[model samples]
Target chain A: MIEVSEAGLLRRRSVVPALLAERGDMLVVAGLGAPAWDVTAAGDHDLTFPLWGAMGGAAVIGLGMAIARPDRRVLVLTGDGEMLMGVGSLATIAVQAPPNLSIVVLDNERYGETGGQRTHTGMGVDLVGMAIAAGIPQTMRINLPGEVEALRQAIHTSTGPLFAVVKIDPESLPLALPPRDGAVLSARFRGALLGPAAHLE
Target chain B: MAGKDWPAALFALLQAHRVRQVAVVPDAGHAALIRLVEASNEMRLVPLTTEEEGIALLGGAWLGGQRGVLLMQSSGVGNCINMLSLAASCRIPLPMLITMRGEFGEFNPWQVPMGQATPTVLEAMGCAVRRADAPEDVAPVADAMLGLAYNTFRATACLIGQRVLGAKTFGIAPQ
Candidate 1:
């Protein structure tokens, strides 16, 4: 849970693009709703799997991908509401401790899709604290624009299971939706990672 | 007709299927198989805080070109209801081995509700559900479940009946 005024939080649109800038060969799993839009706005790629409605699954999905391909980095970009729903997964990920995985929660402190209901983070639930307590070796709470670069660098180079919560201002933005078909998304991702013939398997 | 060897036989089946990851929520009914998975050099045992994570985890594993399975009890199946949509929507090949509880010879009254509803709920969510009441049927049924899942990219589960798993007793400890 987080407790801070929305006075100086980074804008999500600016922050997501910055986090994804110069992204090369990194496999991304975006959480449902706004985080999905945020990633799509940054730029959609075959390697990116933007979830339509697996509300609490982004991190663990990255965990599976990270475990399967240790050579590639996996990033899970999600929102605070989604992260809280699957908070127990932090413990699961920590135990696995995949060096190639990183999770970044975009904390707007509101369930953006559900008519802006205040999430626990708005009332001061520390997600980073939960991550640390769950035994994740690296944890960061990014409240500034400069910190995003550090988080991005960590995603590409750090030995992690790293967890970061970027505190962003809750401004409902225009939808940048990815393809709604899960099969197509899954097929494209697999085709890019493996080959075009891989999905047929 | 098999002896008390279905757990080991089941492990053999998983190994034969090339199941590289075992996503499990610890259940006493699954203890023997869990022990085998723990000892196997070829399998990565992922202990989950809850069962739902297994659905997404295995889906990701499949995305990265690895096969996996989930092992849990009936109660945990309830936790996986919403997450099962990931498998259904993505056409993820999810094979699950679930040991039954709160059905036959169950001493705990609390286990009954979910246990009775397990198969129905799974079926409602588009899982091809099967059951094995005898020791000999366990491995074969599971093999069929896995075959259907991976071959068709469908989520399937084999519910190992309480009779096969041996129901939990709540009586006083033996002196």
Candidate 2:
């Protein structure tokens, strides 16, 4: 059995906004389920691309964005379950090693969307270890709220493919859903990123 | 065009189409194209562990205003099924170059099922499928598919036949 350190477990609501506060020109990719809600709850922006159902793809998507727009910072916020599903992406991203990309896994230790079932993280799967092994330049496991500021700083300003596993309380929150229409969401994001010329295309 | 010229010609076409990213799950059939992409400093080659990651990667690439292609074997198609929904629903441009398996001079029984199902499955997921059975057909089919994908924001697949890839011999020693 894996023991979670509950003493300093951060609330998803507070942590997400704190990380995203004053985020300017940052393109965000939220993994499906809870992380999507967390990002929307923080504040839905035209630049935020909240995924509806792509379970294990958030990081690689962020990598694509980082590669495409090298000038902008790309942050992927996903759940531990989602991160574990696409863990191999760490190696892929590491090889490219785009300096503009950062991935944060909200480690709630359970698959919150699928009835709170315990995930591999709860069974002692270390995402940070896996990322480090995969050659990511920076890796962190954030168990305390104090560590969040440094993680947030690293996310906003780091020359790296940075990986952070943020331990959050598993307590379910109210669903703060984004628009369900994938096309609309994508168009809006592209418009926000590329301006009005995006819609002309 | 000779058999060896197809890969280089296809690479040239991808560059012409502004495909800056190439996501691939390494396969023997894609070896030539992969080598060209790797050797070129102009394109970024993303090596994926599974084929499904390529689907999402291409979606994100399109969203960021960069074109990309997914290269994989027929067997990897099964891995991409669920992820294809993202592209199909959002109208993300996905250009897939899949090498055929289990259709001609077959040695492995394991490759048949998904290989046969590739077209139907991709079509059902809203991808336009086109096949290339000979060396000469490769470039034109790829060019047409890339145009369909990027121009109309449609997911397209160009399935290169096993005959074009040269069927693998049975019981070959490991290199």
Candidate 3:
């Protein structure tokens, strides 16, 4: 729940690349549903995986990977509407206390899934407020580029499950993904995390 | 075969580890345990939209390296169809504490379908269903089921019938 103008969200879109660059062995879950927060650059780097029909369940899936591969970092790239759909996930995540999980929400304040229905998230719901109440150790909300200095500092330096929200614009930049199906992406994603032996096991 | 005290004992054993998160999809049969879960602040309650989500979450929490339990009535097994695929493919061991629904002599017409499907559904997915029929068996069975679910990384089961979790519902509370 960082309150920023729609344009502010657009300017900070590049931060996605920076976030991705800093973390090693972390999986970023994404789909057409997520706002265009430099997903173009991310896809350019071949770094996103789309899951099944569940729109807001990325963090839940990411949690699975974190538990399976305790050695690596697991990050979930999600939206506000999806987060709200599985709101109970927050309480569950806090209880698990996995320091390897870092959830980056590109909150544009609408259900971008169905082509933008207005949502309570954009209506001043204060998601950070929800995280705090749910018992996350740290909730970082950033509206400006410089605020992300702290966000970067927090992610690279921190350990354990952390909640950080970055406000983005509803209107996004041009981005396109491969014509590849969900299966290919899932297989590749799972293979990357759990090698071929994982399949046999 | 069992009595109300059985569910209480199972809850107390699960309650032993500071069981902080419980995910429940509502069912009248499970209402008592749900109420017990909510009554304890140490155990935060996550009431999901469907039992499938509850299944997904229990696995998710375990992966996040945390302990999570799924609470649901037997009928929810039908709702868990596709999700079982995700769990199997991921090889996540989920230990679900189910309040069995629609079994022999179940007066509610709705419980019959999924109640009948319960055993087959769990078996088909390779989930081991352990029934706790009386008060005495509740704790040991629950502790064993919890361990198998977490340690085995496959879905472990506690299929609690009417007598164990509580007596059969007469459609109203007994005063």
> For each candidate, C-alpha RMSD in Å?
2.9, 3.4, 7.1
- Worst 10-residue lDDT window for candidate 1 chain A reads A1-10
lDDT of 1 at B100: 96
Candidate 2 clashing pairs, residues 3+ apart or interchain: none
TM-score of chain B of each: 0.96, 0.95, 0.83
Superposed model 2: Cα runs more than 4 Å off: A1-8, B1-4, B171-175
**Evaluated with DockQ, which candidate comes out highest?**
1
Tens-place lDDT digits, model 2, residues B1-175 = 5356899988999889989999999889889899999999889999998999998898888889888999999999989989998887778989999999988776777888988899999998889999999899999999999999988887899999998988787777424
Model 1 lDDT, residue B104, Cα:
84
Binned by DockQ into CAPRI classes (incorrect, acceptable, medium, high), candidate 1 is high
> What tens digits encode model 1's per-residue C-alpha lDDT throughout A52-138?
987788899999999999999999999999999999999999999999999999998999998999999999899999999999998
The ten-residue window of minimal lDDT in model 2 chain A covers A1-10
- Of the native A-B interface contacts, what share survives in model 2? 0.64
Q: After superposition, which runs of candidate 1 have C-alpha atoms over 4 Å from their true positions?
A: A1-6, B1-3, B172-175
Question: Which candidate number would show the highest TM-score if scored against the true structure?
Answer: 1
Q: Can you list the residue pairs that collide in candidate 1?
A: A1-A124, A1-A125, A1-A126, A2-A124, A2-A125
